[model samples]
Target: MSALRVALADDQALVRAGLRALLERLGIEIALEADDGAALLAQLADTPVDVVLSDIRMPGVDGIHALQALRARGDATPVLLLTTFDDSELLLRAAEAGAQGFLLKDAAPEDLFDAVTRVAAGETLLQPVSTDPVRARFHFRDDRAPVDSFNPREVAILRLLAGGYSNREIARSLFLAEGTVKNYVSVILDKLGTRDRTRAVLKAITLRVI
Candidate 1:
């Protein structure tokens, strides 16, 4: 297989250098590097990559804004936001902004590599950081529609979702058809009153259902 080409963006030069070394050691190719989100986007306009590894906070455009812009332009490229802080609000914002994964800058190299690979393969990754902070800071609105109870099988699927498994992966693990897994995911999202898998996982965590 060809090496995974990645675009890396961070404000700190040292951090970017360290990450580049680690990724290169793992045989991953760095297609482009940028000091901030704006540069990252500008470079991406000319360079295509398999994945994007970026810091969530930066001087201009930041990771969240960069990701929003990418999605707005119909770019579905998987993005993994890295951060030094474990701020719950930022995590939620990243998820809402269409980030494929969120990881701390201090994450192990293997963990970082795994996150990139998984996101590149179309999996939503949110397991590196604990969800307790999210649950604590999540404001539950009383006016929101009540969530439906999930069956045992659905709960099992929720667990897999929390682990960042894609529908096809979950289907294979549960010995179900891919289409069936998609249906279960739809049901889970409905039960959680969420519009996306990441939001569903966050809600599930907030509800302590997974």
Candidate 2:
């Protein structure tokens, strides 16, 4: 495989320098570095970067806004948020803005490397704290909820999951087998355009699906 070229965006020059060294040791190339979102976007347009590692908070622009800008410009290069906090609201916003993954600022060197690799390969990787509760909140709703994409069965299943019901509880409530509930949950994940249960719900919520 070709070496993954990455752009790192953060206001901290020391952090960028350290990250550059770490990634270089693993044979990754630093295509560019930026102090804020706007510079990051300019670099992305000017350079060839397979992945973007961005800080959630910066001086001129923020990570979520940068993510939105990339998507609006139709760039599908994977974007990962590097953050120090794990707020659910921020998680929801990141997912909605099209971030492929989120890594804690204090993550181990190996963890950062793995996140970069996975997201560049079109995978979503999130820290456990930011990934788990998403399962309890994503769903089908609004005008689109009644469509075939959701339907009554899928809606029922989502409501149960969002309310903290287990598969068995959902099955009992819906008069379906436990396996059937599991299957519906799988379908929910696929139709919602997300990487996992949390992301799925966040997508559903963003789309007003649930």
Candidate 3:
């Protein structure tokens, strides 16, 4: 497939520079880069990008506003929000504003690429490690419950895992054998259509299963 075209918007020059470098390394094209949300909107007027990676907080017309403006214009371009804090309120706002994905500013390079690719391919991308703690702390509304594919017990295990518990710890906490916990984790990964625990946790969180 052709390299996906991506636009980046962040107030920090260094953050934009670093993200550009990372996207280039992954063979993703930098269609445009803007220092803030207003500039990002202006750039989008002329640039046709597959995805937009915008920081949530900006001096003016932040990511949320930008997303709102895009929706107001009836633009269907996918947007992925980036933030430094894992604030549940902020996340809910982004979701309400119609962000296609949410990610931490410090996400791993691989995770960034994965998120960009998935969002570009029309998938919603919200990872657990970034949002789980805030959701747990604030008890965010479980508006998007897990699909019927994920059973209740598996969702329980995923919630514990998202809290950073290890397999043995989850086994002890859930009163299951370590082997059984491992098997459940594998099943969770499969059901979530992810290849690893972290991704599974994230997928579950995005689905509001945890």
Candidate 4:
């Protein structure tokens, strides 16, 4: 397989350099590097990458704004936002802005790499970060109730979903067929009243269901 190509954007030169070195050591290509969100967007106008790893905060456009711009222009490229802070509000904003993944700056190298790979392969990841804060701060709509409940098996699947596992991976982990996992995921989404897996996971977290 070809090496994974990633566009990296961060305000700090040292942070960018460190991440570049780490990713290169893992055989991933740093397709483009930018110091800020505007430069990242400009570079990506022509450069095609498997994934985008960017810091959530920057001087100008910022990662969230850049991601919103990309989506506005119909770009579905997977984006993973990085941050040094465990700000639940910022995480919720990133998710609302269509980020495929979110990670802390101090995440283990393997966890970072895995997040990139998973988002690149069309999976949404938000692991190693506790959702407790999110649940505490997030408020559902007045009409929305946190009353829906999942069976034990479905709860297990929901946990895997929160970990960003794809159906096949969930199946393998749960000793079920991939099709069974898919059906379970469908039911989970229905129970959460969301069609998107990321939203479902977020809703589940907000409900303290998982």
Q: State the TM-score for model 3.
A: 0.65
**Where is the poorest 10-residue window by lDDT in model 1?**
139-148
How many residue pairs of model 2 clash at the backbone?
5
What candidate 3 gets wrong by more than 4 Å, as runs, is 128-209
Clashing pairs in 1: none
Cα displacement (angstroms), candidate 4, residue 50, comes to: 0.7
Q: Order the numbered candidates by TM-score, best leading.
A: 4, 1, 2, 3
Model 2 ranges with Cα > 4 A deviation: 128-186, 190-210
Give the Cα lDDT of each candidate.
0.86, 0.76, 0.79, 0.87
TM-score of each: 0.85, 0.68, 0.65, 0.92
Ranked by TM-score, the better of candidates 1 and 2 is: 1
**lDDT of model 4, residue 136:** 70
| lDDT (Cα, 0-100) at 55 in candidate 4 | 93
Tens digit of per-residue lDDT, candidate 3, span 1-210: 799999999999998899999989999999999998899999999989999999989998999999999999988899999976646667767765778778888889998998888778766655433565544533324435446777778888887765546677778988999999999988888776778655565556666676
Candidate 4 residue-wise lDDT, 119-174, digit = tens: 99999987744687767766778324544467889989988988989999999999
Q: Where in model 1 is the C-alpha error above 4 Å?
A: 128-133, 136-148, 171-180
Question: Per-residue lDDT for 17 in model 2?
Answer: 94
- Displacement of residue 153 (Cα, Å) in model 2 is 18
* Winner of 1 and 3 under TM-score: 1
